[model samples]
Target chain A: MKFDFNNNIPIYIQIVEQIKTDIVAGKFKPGERLPSVRDFANETKVNPNTMQKALVELEESGLVFTERTNGKFITHDTSLINFYKQKYAEELTLTYLKRMYDIGYSLGEISKQIEQLGGNK
Target chain B: MNTILELKNLNKSFGAKKVLENINLTIPRGKIVGLLGKNGTGKSTLIKLINDLLTPTSGEVLINGKSPSVESKKIIAYLPERTYLDKSMKVAQVIKYFAEFYDNFDSQKAYKLLEELGLDVNQKLAKMSKGMQEKVQLVLVMSRKADLYILDEPLGGVDPATREYILDTILSNFNEGASVIISTHLINDIERILDDVIFINDGKIILHSECDKLRTEQGGSVDEIFRRMFRC
Candidate 1:
């Protein structure tokens, strides 16, 4: 997982975003084990408590599972990954579309650009 | 559309030191508000005044556009910064007490939450861990389904897992047209869920805005802005 310490966003949220990206990119396959909180925090130079908060949010959202003695692992379900990816994609696309429209882009022109970018499929 | 609570030029002091000064806040219904401030600020005092636990030395506190009275107490559910549960009482007894007092209390929801938290109703408050007690307190406060939910330091002294549970309980239990105020110094953890925010310092409001608009106008995350504004 990657963390940009210089970014203004909170460290925990950055960790969450990176984990989600890894899940979508297949870096963490279904049912794969994740590094323990301490090890991950040590490697990333973040507080263990902050890392724990990110992992807790993931578990709460059903993207990860924690075993008391064993450790946290990626959920054995890609559907959750797909679900989040689609949700995020739709959110991001709407944001982009809004900004484009605010800049006076016509629907036809936007559609054409999207199509040219292989969005029509 | 009535003002659910208002503080008019309220001033409060503890011993020889002044805490809140000329504090005025008017809160409307159905808004989820974040109360942001550093430690020892008057955020908790504001909550206490609303709940009638402490009286303002000067000025006024109103509930539903009237002075805070006994009837106002009936509609407020207060979760304090520290544990308020009687250590000798069992969870079941606490639930029963709350049910007897609150007109809108939902015992079933409380039991369901307890079960989800892996807590048994028969567990004594003294026997449970600190995190478990916090959960119980949250369960009791949320089960009331009051007109106003005033949670002081709701996320204090709890694990993130339990904090999520507490937040979800707050989110799921409140009905439409109900308002909630969560006071905390930990802004980042709860920033995403806040509809509005009131930033307090030394018992005075320094900032108040709709959460999204504040983030957009400031052009940074709430935590970042807070860190800058309250730089140490």
Candidate 2:
């Protein structure tokens, strides 16, 4: 995984958002064992404490769970994953729309442009 | 103890000149803290005081609730701003010397790190570039299983790639429950790895804050904030 961090936001928050995006995009398989915090921190080139905080945030959201001696694993709840996927899509769409509007593009124009781009893809 | 290091009402002066004034700080375990300032801002002086290299005119420097002593030296591994190793010593000999000098030094880990960095053990310090020597020093320092590692300007004068390697070595090698204090003027390169930051200016601490909270509150990177605050 690659991280292009924006120092304007908290590092751990950025990691949490990136991991969430990865989970919803199927980059990390459901129920797959997560790497140890130290390994993950090394991979991300972040502090271990920041990585631990991100994992704790993920756990709080039910996307990750810890097994005492075994380690952390991604949730196997497909419904929850799908729900997050939809929510993420909505967020991206809203951001795109807001940017387009700021640049003087209308809702109709955005739909037409998106449809054209999607067709090409 | 929970607090790995503390300073209370610390003050230092040289003759008529005041180098540091009325400083107080506390550092908890398992943290990476950045001591940041412009050149000649007493950053080195503060670090020296912490390491007991210089005596404070007033106040106390405490490690694990005790004053700086042989006990504190045992738990704190220090990397000074200048290279202190013998230039005539080969890398392997240096490792052996460190192993004999510091009880907690791990020669195997040092060798592994040296191999990973592609540094030849037989190469003398004088044969290597300044950056390479600094890397060797960093590898040795990280190999020690110390509770608190105090690195002074570890990233200074190194290439970008070497800086990344230095940061990676620090991140990967520290023991659990240990804390690291890195002093540098280059904030952007090291800010991401810092849990907290201490900003000193004119012999006083101007700001001390958690990295994430500071970023969020100030709406900028630590480097940006430092530039803005210390603008000429």
lDDT of candidate 1 over B147-166, digit per residue (tens) = 88999998888888677567
- Clashing residue pairs in candidate 2 (N, C-alpha, C atoms within 3 angstroms): none
Candidate 1 wrong stretches, greater than 4 Å:
A1-121
State the DockQ, from 0 to 1, for candidate 2: 0.79
Best by the TM-score measure: 2
Interface RMSD of 2: 1.0
Best by lDDT: 2
- Scored by DockQ, the top model is 2
* Residue A62 of model 1, lDDT score: 88
